[model samples]
Every structure is written in structure tokens, then in C-alpha cells.
Target: MATTNNIDNKRYQGLIISIALFLSLIGALLAFTFYTSSLLERNTALIDQTNQVANSAQAVIKDLFDLESSYGEDISSPHIQRVLTRLEENTALITNSLSAIEQGGVITDNLGNRYQLPNISNDARLDVAEAKEQWNVLEPKIQTYLKDANNIMVSSADELAQAVDQAKTSSLFINESLDKLTRDVFSNAERQATTIRLIQVLGVAAIFAYFLIFVFFFVRRLRETDAEALAARRETQEIMQTVNTGLFLLDKDLKIGQQHSRALNKIVGEENLAGENFTNVLRGRISDKDLNTTKQFIEQLYNPRVKEKLVDSLNPLTKVLLHNTSGTGSDSRFLDFKFSRVYEDKDIARILVNVNDVSDAVYLEQRLEKERSQNDMQIEMLTTILNVKPKVIHEFISNTKAHIEKMNNILKNPGSSQYELEAKLKAIYRDMHSLKGDASALKLHSFTKIASDAEDKLSALQNQGALSGNDFLQLAVHLDDLLSLSNTIEMLGERINQTSAASTKAAHTTPTATAAGVRAAGAIDSTPQANSQVIGSLDFDEGEDIDLDDESDSHLLAYYQDFAQDIASRQGKEVQLNSATLEQVQIPERLKKTVKEISIQLVRNAIVHGIEPPTDRRSAGKPSTGNISLEMQSVGQDFIVSLQDDGQGIDYDSIRQKLVELGRFSLEEAEQLDRNQLLKQLFSSGFSTKDEADEDGGRGVGLDIIKTQVKESNGKLNVNSELGEMTRFVITLPKAS
Candidate 1:
């Protein structure tokens, strides 16, 4: 076995030597590779420097040539002539403009270097001047010798070279040593040929040995690495699929590229967006645009002059682009799209377009906008409601419908006469006038606007004024609008009723016939004076209602006597009632009921109880008559009513004495009370100072009843009395709202 092992060892020696040689070759090759890479990097850098220098020099030469060309081109424009003339006339102004332009007044462009702008800055203008001066001096001369220009240029070059050579000692690039260095660097590859060949021979030997060992292990490891790479690619794809936003990948051609999410696929499939052009996609799914615009945006990719975003094709506001992923609209809920540039240099260069569906977010945003508009309208409605008196506004709605109901009445009785037409128009005018006053009082601008227009039309018709075709057309349209507004008020009023609980407003309050009578009776200024042409122009005749009664057959005395006799007969007692001013009283329409009720009550009370019997009146040295008088007067903001009787005056001392006897007040308190306070006891609710004794009638609530009734009519009541003489009550109530 030992001898066999020895033979085996000898046979393997050659293999071992081969392995050693292979390992040695690997180290040699790696070092050579590193050295070659460094040399290549240096060469690349030098080449880049040479290119930059050439490009810069070429740009300067081109700029100068452009300047010369531009100067030649602008010789005839009006603006160019103007600028030239001005420059010639005022060189100092141009100098000042130049100074202002030169002093750091420019914005640096994208590369952080200033390109003095053409219109406003000094550099462009300076170039213009320089170009102009040279061209002005030489252009005309050069044009004359055009064929011989090239020959002249060649001669000029020879002369220039000789002149430069004359100053050789001062030349920048022409020294002997510098010339040699430049030549070596730029021109001589063969100069180092032998040395380079030796290096190459050594390098080849080393590399051959090294590659043997390197390839064996490298090939083995490559298989394992490739397996890991496949696994990583699978993981990346899985992550993209699992991300929260819906995704739609697009190709550079802008077709429905690819979809990862179920939701995204459904939208595209439902919309038929897969093969449609992007701009015309508005037809199918409303990607909502021109396809060419979308394509153009995608084409920009990441052109730096614009935004440095991948979506060069679309608004960055609504869309975005990422290398492999993009989202649009709400970040949390994307309705946006992205176009990404990936690996542009390789054949794999592609646009990875992404889309995110933001339907719910967009819907919510629209809903909010709609709600805002509604809220603004609601505020306007509330402002309108605030402008009107609640009662008038309510009536406007309720009464307008009633007034419109009259239209049906007119329709039923449709008769046309010039006179009847005038009456019908006047009725319409009354309603319109009421509308105008109510609208004006409320400062309701919209309501007044509609009502005034209706009124003017009616007024024109009523007065037999001309109604041109346009006027009638406008009137019909306007009246329709007013009628529509009336219905709106009714609808709004219904809403108001639903929301408000405490209002005394009835549905409609119309003008009463009695109220019209009141206007007729009280407004005597409408009566014509004999000499006056216009009736109602005279001031009110105050003496007209006055009656110092004379004849018993007269209206004034007959009314008084009849009223008194009725009281006396009703009470089974004699009562003499007189009006210092009865027929003289100009009764308002609203005051008719109130005046009658108050007058009768006062006279009856005096006849029944306020007086003694007729015998007592006679004994008191008065006629056997219980005398009462009524007077009326108009005062500021109110009408005053006075009722006076000389039957038996109210006894104030008795009232104070009774208040003390009752448990309501102390004798000391009664003693301190004034006469007015004592008299007020008679008007107290329950406890009366006067009782139903000594053949007189009292229920203990007479004055209280009087006070209650007066207060109910929104009136104030007070009494003044003199013992055994006259007693009087004064009442006042408002005449208007």
C-alpha cells in the first residue's frame, strides 16, 4: 500500500503544479485589470477636457459671427432706426442705461450663470454696438469686393502670422519646450511602442495563469447568486401588488399599460379604456382630455427646463410619476396618475404609468362644494325675512293668494267697457299700491322691485296712458315674475310656520270696509273748496265737527237727547247726556265700535248708581237730570277720550277710608296716600270702596271692569273727581301700528 501511495503522489504532482500555476495567474490578472482601469479613467478625463475647450472656443466664435450677421440684418427696421437715431442724439442716455444694466441687476438662469436678456440688459446691447461699429465700417466695402474677399483674407493671414512672429519672445504657445510637450501629448503613439509591447507580453502571461483559478470559483458562485436574484424579483413584484392604492401601469405609448389591483382592472374594463386613445378617452371613461396633450406630457419625461418630475406629459397637480410606482389625487385616496422614466439608456427604457382611483374622494369634494352654495343661498333668504315686518310679510303671502283669487272672479265676470276697464284697473292699482307701500316699509328691495314694476304698468293702464307693444310685453313678463314671487313667499311662510312656535299672526289680514269709511270721514282734506280746482288740497277745517247745540231738531242735539233718553229709560232713571262735540267728532273707521261702547257704559253707570234718585238730584240743587258729556280730541300719536258727568262725584275719602277698613292696608298707609292714590282704590280689582248699599247698585268691579276694558283696547284710563260735583275719566289709545 505504501508503494501504491508513492506512485499515486507522483502522478498527482503534475496536477498540483497546474493548480498552483492557476492560482498565481489570478492575482496577476486582477492587478493588471486595476491598472488598466486607472489608465482608461485618465484618458477619459483628458478627452473630456479637450472637448470642453473646443466647445467653448467654438461657442465664442459662433457668437461673434452671429453678432456680425444680426448687425447686417437690422439695417432697415423702423425700431432699429429709432434706436440708432436716439443713440446718435443722446450718447449720454445710452451710457446711463448701460450702467444700470451692468450693475448686478439680472437674474441667473437655470445653470446659475446670467445670460443678459436681449431686451433690457447691457450685454446684448453692448454686443449690438460692437457688431454695429465693425459692420458699419466694413460691410459696404466688403460687399463691393465679394469675389476677391477670400483671396484678401488669405493675404491678410500671411501678413498677420509674420507680424505675430516678429514678437516671438512674447508669444504664449510657441516656445520650444512647450511645443514639444504639446506634440508628445497629442500626436506620438509610436514613440513608446517597444516599451508598451514588453508590458503587454508580461501582462498576457500573468492573466492566463490567473484566469484558470478565477473561472472555476466564479462560475460556481454565479449560479447561487442568480437564484437569489430571482427570489428578490418575486418579492418586489409581490410588494407592488399588495400596496394600498389601486395601480394601473402604462407603456410609453400610453395604452392601458397594466393593472395590479382588482379595483383598477374593473374600472378600465368597464370603461372600455384599454385600447382607446388617451386624449379621446373622454368619450369612453372620461380620462377627460385630448390624447395628444397626454402624449406630449409623457414625452417630456424629465426635461430639466421644466419640473424635475417624471410626468413630463401631464399636470403635476393631478398626476405623479415614480420609477416603478406612481399615484394621483389624494395621497390617502388617489384619483391621480403618474408616468415614470425607467432605465432610459437601455432597450428596457420604458414609461411606467400609474393610476389611482379616487371616486369617493372626488364625490365628497363635490358634495362639499354643493353644500357651500346652498348655505350661501340660505343666508340670503334669512336676510330677506329679517327685512320685513312679520305681520306684513305674512299677509303679503296670504293676501296675495286671496288677491289672485279675485282674478278668477274677474274671469267669471269678464265684461269690457272703457269705464269698467278703468274701474278694474283701479282695483288692480289698489292692490299694487298696497304692495308697494308694504314693500317699501319693510325695505324689502327684491319685493319692492317686482311690485313697483307691476304698479307702474297698472298706473299707466288706469290713466289711459299709452301702452306700447314693448311696454305690454315687459308688463306681462314682469307681472308673471311678481306672481311667482308671491307663491315663493307662501312656500317660505309655510316653512316659517313649521319652525316658529310663538306668533300671533293670522293667515291674512285684509283692509276692512269700516277702515275705508274711517279714511273717508277723518280725511276731510279730500273735500273740495268752492274756488279750488284740485279737491283735497285744502287743509282740514277744524271747526267743521264743532257743535254748540241750538235747535232740538238739529242732528247734533237730536243725537245727544236720543242717547240720553235711551240711557234714562234703560235704567229707570233720568240722565241728561250732552256732547260738547258729538256731530263735530270725526270718527275714524276703527274707532266706531269702541266709541259707542265706552259712551253707553259711562252714561248708564251715572244714571243707575253714580247719581242718586231724581229726588236726590233735585235736593242737590241740580235739575232732575244726571248730566254727562263726551269729548274727543286728536293728540300727538293718540286719540284722547273724556267722559264727564255731574251726577254725584266719586268720594275719594270714602275710598281711602274703605282701603283702611279692608285688610289690604294700614290706616297709617292710607293717611299718607295722595288723593290720586286714594282714587285708584276705586279701580282696584276685587275690593271696592263703594258698596251696593243705600239704594245704589255696585258689584265691586265697576272701575276694575272699566280699567280692564280700556287696557284690552291698548288704552290708558284715569279718573279725576270733585266731591258732590263732576267726575271724569280720560282715555288714550294709539291711532296706528
Candidate 2:
């Protein structure tokens, strides 16, 4: 690995160097090209300037010649004056053009931008001065001739001819000097062009040499690296194919390696497992919670601060049971997972995971453990049977069966209307609480465990104050489990009785109570006193009646009132519940369960969320005790149940803000929602004003479940609230079929 890493580092460094060199060469070539192009433009511009100056000089000479030719002709004085004016304009143009060539000034460019041109060479400057001197000497002579020509009557035509001859001679000298200046500019432009071309060629040659050197080195390194990589790949392939255990590598991002063992796919129940996130692959196999924990565990393994051994206990994938989806659901397999860090030069390179299927061994171990537990339980049961009175065992079983019946009745016959959820909750809590206490008194360990679990669920519901119809429905599963165990114990008791009857009948023993007790005590030899203590706890003489099917005659409204009073006393507050007669309203048995669930939830919500304590009421100048009222009646085909409490009403503004906070609506949308729309949010799941979950309120589910039950029964839930006044929920349900 070290050797491979060194080779890789060297190759990477070489690649970087090659790229830098190539970029440098290209940069140099570009700089040279821009410089050469600039030089070429300047040289061309200078040559053109020289030519323009020469043309201007020739224009002056041509005008002088025309003036000289017109002097000899019988031209009028006006025509002579015009010729002289043309001659002077041409002379001035030549002088200005020459001065511009000597001293740089603004010239219009192709883009109509003014750009300054540089001064010409010294030789061109000297030529311009000579031409200017010659023009000065000839200008006065021409003007004097023009004066003579205008006075054709006083002056002879010879003076005009003499002036023209002098002007022509000066023009010739200026033209000769301009011509020499133009040749010098052209010769210099040619030399500069040659130099620019030569520099460009040299630059290209240097770039080519640099590129060739890089290519030769890069190719040699690439070939060497490829050969080494090919050999390593072949070796890795052989190992991957032969390995029995599921082996795979994970990179820094926890992505599976491209070259993983074939067994890895089978273990994880996926094909083409490579390149996929390891967590995602396991998602279908393990629970999301476990998958997250597994990811954390793997991450911890990679943490430099944490020791691998220290995090071994945190490994969530260790001995995880995975259900084989590829087969029948019954096929569950346990996988033993192991992780190791693959290091390159003392740094973590990748993580290696090894999965070994331990399904058979785990299954065997579990079977042995279960058999041992069963053997011990059976022995304990026999000992308890021999020690305790037969009546007590029968009584315990009977009591448990009665409790189970009560639970089923609670589910089947829900008390109160759907709007009085609190009443139903109180009733359910009483039932489950009674069952737990009775089971504990009897010391039925297995029965108590199941019963205790059920009681705990009821307590959770009470604490959360978020009761739903489905919440009660969920209890049926635990009830069934408890009933199943009850039936098992009943069967066991029957078998014990038969065995006792057979032994007694065979011996024909007339056993006295005292002797029977003595024999029972002797069976629990080590704790004879404890055995007597267990039997002595129950009164055998006074037979306890067990009525499994008994239904209470309590009115729903009265029960809620009593329940509210009881809760008020517990809370150290005073509250009164007033209600209209619900007896006349016939609630269908089909809707009873839903109605019961909703009623319990709503009543609890009222006392916990809507009703204020006595002190708060007194401070508000109301009565010391608060009042909660429930009214239910049948109207046409609908049954309407309404409940109200004189307490702090719903905070519409708070609800609106909450809606925005929860992302259910934007701030603008929430603000636009009227009182009616905002009140509907109270029935939304997970919506509540309470900060903490308690038996009375919070847990946000009460109103939600009430609404759901009402809707399921083809009913409608409506809310009305005035801040600092009263809050009411009126539910209207269609009469059940």
C-alpha cells in the first residue's frame, strides 16, 4: 500500500507539473502574438503617415504650377486672385501636414476615436523645416506678383511670371525633401516587420519544444502507472471472488466501492451494490432508526477522537436480524457485521465491512434459551399450584377474565356522545387501572406483565390528553394478547385440577382442610411461612361474586360531571359541570364507540385546556368555581352534541402564527384566514397551545381525534370562541344506520 501510494503521489505531481508547463507555454505564445500584432499596426500607420505628407506636398506644387500657367495666359485679375488664393491654401495645407508629422497630434481612427500619432524621424523633421523655409521665401514673392497682376494696367506680366518661377523652384525643393522622408519611413517599417516575423517564429519553436517534452514524460508515467494498476486489479478480483464472507469497502462518503465481493450483494439483498450509499442499501433491510444509528456507528469508527474498540458497543448493525424479502417473510436471517479501517500511510483510506450470516447459530441459541425459560416457568407454576390454595388460583383466573370482559365492553359500548371525549377517557382509565391493581394483588406475574403494559398505554393516553378513536382501537391488540394468556392459564388450571382429582380418587383419601393446608405448605419447604402467607391473604369463606357482563346504569352527563369534579379536586381547583339531559337522545350502538372516544377527548380538553382554576375565575370577577356545560339532542336526522367551558377562549392570532410557523400556510395566508378558518386548525393533528404533555391537556390530539370520529360517522365539527370568554365545540353527526 505504501509503495502504491508513493507511486500515485508521484504521478499526480507529474500531471500537475505538465499542466502548468503547458499553460505557461500557451500564455507566452499569446503575449508574443499580441505584441507582434501591435508592432505591425504601428509600422503600417507610420508608413501611411509618410505617404499622406508626400501627397500634400505634391498638391501644393500642382497648385503653384497652375498659378504659373495662368499668369502667362490672358486671364482676368479676378481669375489671377483666385489662383493666388488657391496657391496660398495649398501652401498652408502642406506646412500644417508637415508639422503634424513632426509633432504628434490627434488623428481620427477607423472607430471614429481620436488617437495621437508619434513624431516622425529626425531626417523627416529636417526635411519639413527645409520645405517650410523654402515656402516662406516664395510666399512674399507670390503675393507681390498677385499685387502686380491685379494692377494689369501699371505692372507688366513679367513680374507675375518671375513670382511664379520662384514659387515653382521652392515647390520642387520641398517635394524632393518630402520624397526622401517617405523613403526613410518605408525602409524603417520594412526592417521592423522583419524583426517581428523572426520573433514570432522563435516563440512558436520554443512552445513546440516545451509541449513535446511534456508529452514524452506524461506518456511514460501513464504507461507505468497503468501496468501497475492492472496487476493490482487482477489480484483484487481474485480475492473478491474467493472470499466467503460479505466484504465491501466504503469511501469517505460511505459509498460502496466499485470492486466489492460478490457475496456483499447477496448479504445486503441487492445487485450492483457498488457505488450506492451503504445506508441507502441497508434502508430496505433495516428500520430507518436503526439505519441512522448504524451510520452514526460507522462514522464514530472513522472518528480519530474515538477508539474503534470503544465504539464497538455502539455498532447498530452487529447481530441484526434481517427478514429475507427474496424469500417468504418467515425467513429471518441474523447478520454479524464487522468493520475495519483501511489505512494508507497511517491515514484512513476506506472502511472495510465484513458481513457474516449467523442465522443458524442465532436461531439455535434462541431456541435453547426459550426452552430453558419454558422449563423454569413450568416448574415454578407447578410449585405455586402445590403451595397455594386451589380456590385462589381459580379466583385469580376468574378475576382476570372479568377484567378482559370489561375492556372489551369499553371498546364495544362507548359511553357519552362523540363531543364528550374526556368522559370516555376517564371511564377507560378507571377500567384499565382497576384491572392492573387486581392483577397485582393476585401476584400473577405473566398476567400482570401484559396487564401492566395495557395500563401503561392508558396512562400515556391520559397524560398526553390527546385521545383519538384509533387510540382506543389500538388497545384491542393488547387486550387480545392478555385474553390469550388468560385462556392458557385457565387451561393449565383445568389440567391441574384433573391431576389432583385422579390422585385423590385412586387413593380414596378424605382430605381435611388442615391436612391439605399442611401438604401445600410442605411443597414450598424453603418458604413455608410465605406459602401460608399467600393463601391467608384471600378470604375463602366469603365467596366473591364475579360478574363479567354487568353494565353500569350511570348517565353519561352525570359521569362527566363527577369526573370533572374529581379532576378539579386533584388539581386543587374547583369546577362545576352542568349538562342537559342526554338520556332521551338515542345514540346508535355503531356510533357509540366513536362517540365515546370523542366525548372522552373533548371533556378532557375542556377541563385541561379551556376551564380555568378557581383563583383565576375569582380574579376575573367571575364566580370562585368555573362552569363547563354539555348539551346533546337529536334534531331531525342529526344528533348534535355541544360542550362549552367559561375559560380563556382560543387565541386566534396565536393559531395563525402557528400555522405560518408550521409551514401549513404563509404568514400572509394565515393572517387572511378569518376566525372560523383559524379555529379549524385546533382540530389539526399535532396542534395545541399547551407547552408540555400532561394528563389534563397538551399532546394536541384531543380535538383532532374528536373531529376525525365525527367525520367518520358522517358528522361535522364546529367551533366558536371569544377571547377571555368561552370556547365551545358543537359536533353534528348523522344518526347511525
Put down candidate 2 lDDT per residue, 1-737, tens digits, no spaces.
79978877786996997788778878987887887676666656656665665675566456656766665555566776676676666555555556666676555434675545556678767876776677677666666665655554765456557666776687678677777777876776677778878877887888788778878987888888799889988888989888878998898798998888877766666777879988777776778899889888888877877887788877888789886665632356799999988878868788888998888888899999989866665565555555455544555566567767866876777545554555565555545544443343334455556655665576577657555677788788888877776676666756655554444343334346655675677753323344334444221222234332232213466556655765566566677888765544556545555565566666667777777777888888878777888777778888777889898888888888777876779998988998767767777655677766444445455676676667768888888888889988889888855
All models: lDDT? Answer: 0.49, 0.68
**Which candidate wins on TM-score?**
2
How large is the C-alpha RMSD of every model relative to the true structure? 34.4, 15.3
Give a tens-digit lDDT track for model 1, residues 514-547. Answer: 5457457884232123213331122123223313
Model 1 error, position 7 (Å)? 50
**Model 1 off-target regions past 4 Å?**
1-218, 248-252, 255-263, 270-283, 287-290, 309-334, 339-352, 388-490, 497-501, 504-737
Tell me how candidate 2 scores on lDDT.
0.68
lDDT of 2 at 655: 87
